[model samples]
Target: MTRTLEWNVHLDLSEENGTTKAEAVLDTGSEKLMGHGVARCNPQDVDIPTIGDELAASRAMKDVAGQLMRAADREMEAVGAGPTKGPLGKPYAWTDVAG
Candidate 1:
């Protein structure tokens, strides 16, 4: 069976304070859950840094992904599915690149 998963993330940015807070929601058609993360500037009152944004977004997504994987694993286990090593391994295909 093919299933569709939807992930939604909301980021609140405070440019003056150099801080960003993110809330993430994952929906697996039948169930939904939430996660959150924050990013802050090393120096207060500076413009938000790109590195910080990247870090926080990545952290939030990682948490969501982990949760989804766990849920899938549990369902598979219940169905007598054998555990597969590297079942989640995949390569990225980028559509855009900067020269």
Candidate 2:
């Protein structure tokens, strides 16, 4: 069966002392997930707020992706499908974050 569904994502960003931080929120009718990330500008590098925003936002989205994956893993387990083992290859595994 085909179904139509919608989920909303909201992102919040802040910068201070050459550090940019982001929080990504995914809201579903039944649940909400939160993800966070930060980017630090080098002391000698140019302080470009836009670049920092981009980096931090990307990282936050990545965090959300991992969370979604973990959620899927859990559901699959509940159905006796066993570990997700899709990318992380372990139950509720997390994708590595960029450094």
Candidate 3:
């Protein structure tokens, strides 16, 4: 059977003291996942707000992706499907992981 679901993501950003911070939120209907990241401007480097925003936002998105993977791993474990194991663990099926 084919299933379809929609999830929404929102981001919040702030800058203070030469540092840019970003927060990513993923709403999965049943729960909310949060990811945070920060970027600091070096004293010798140019102070570009847009660059900092991009860096922080990228990091925050990466964080959210990692959290989503971990949640999926937990769900697989609950369903008697073990998580994948290797240099970088993942939750996808057909991995080396043995259920």
Candidate 4:
């Protein structure tokens, strides 16, 4: 069997008071996942808009990746894959779920 899929990710960035905020959205025809990130510019460091944007965007994308992994884990369990740890066998549960 062979399968092909295309997932689209959209990143949005904004800056306010030396802080850059980013939101990355991953769209899969059947579901949409979102991640958020923030980057703060140190007062002593040079203020570079591009740097902040990059940092925030990267963090947000990572967040989305994490969410995707966890989602996959949950789906795997639903399908009787049995219990398992995170990617690479590390225990992982978002703060909210862990609590």
Candidate 5:
């Protein structure tokens, strides 16, 4: 059997003098979730300074990815798929990624 799940999250980031916002959507079909982050600068607040849109967006997406991973892990546990552990045995030279 196949199953599908959907998730959505919104995050608000508050810095010393400014606030940023972001949203993420997760769909099982693509095997990956999509995230978008956004930030804005308060012109009147010099202390906050302005981080361009690109930087704010990137930061939001990164945070989304982290949240997705955690959600996946929790779901795995709930389903009794067994604890997530490293590979069965000690690593060998060939086990390295380049190998």
Candidate 6:
């Protein structure tokens, strides 16, 4: 079986008082997930607006990725796939077990 699905991700960024904040929203039609990040510019470092924006946006994307993974794990467990800790201590499917 083959299937195609499209998920939409929207990112919003803002800066104020040397601090940049970012929010990532993932829309899966059936559900919406949100992630947030913030970046601050130090007085010693050069004040670059783009750099702060990039850093905050990157962090927000990472947050969203983590949220997506957690959602997937929960769905997997609901289907009785069984959840286990992977080598890196991440949630994973456990298919080998005795009933």
Per-model TM values vs. the true structure: 0.57, 0.80, 0.79, 0.80, 0.37, 0.79
* Candidate 3 global TM-score: 0.79
Q: Which ten residues in a row are the worst by lDDT in model 3?
A: 83-92
Candidate 6 lDDT for residue 23: 98
Q: Where is model 5 poorest over a 10-residue stretch in terms of lDDT? A: 8-17
**In candidate 3, residue 88 scores what lDDT?**
56
lDDT string, candidate 5, 1-99, tens digits? 997766554443444435565555555555556576666665765544346344565677786677776787798889987455876465335558675
lDDT per residue as tens, model 4, 5-70? 999999999999999999999999899999999999999999999999999999999999999988
lDDT of 6 by residue, 64-95 (tens): 99989888779888998746656555433565
* Each candidate: RMSD: 6.3, 6.6, 4.8, 7.8, 8.1, 6.1
* Per-residue alpha-carbon lDDT of candidate 1 for residues 1-99, written as tens digits (9 for 90 to 100): 997766555544333366666656766556766666677877645554776667667767777878887787898888989366656555334643432
Q: Judged by TM-score relative to the true structure, which candidate is superior, 1 or 2?
A: 2
lDDT of 3 by residue, 1-98 (tens): 99999999899999998899999999989999999989999989989999999999999989999999888879888898855465754435775566
Better of 1 and 2 by lDDT: 2
Q: Indicate the worst ten consecutive residues by lDDT in candidate 4.
A: 84-93
The digit string of per-residue lDDT tens for model 2 on 1-99 reads 999999999999999999999999999879988999899999999999999999999999899989998798688899999554446543332455432
How far out, in Å, is residue 43 in model 1?
A: 3.1
Query: Which pairs of residues collide in candidate 3?
Result: none
TM-score of 5: 0.37
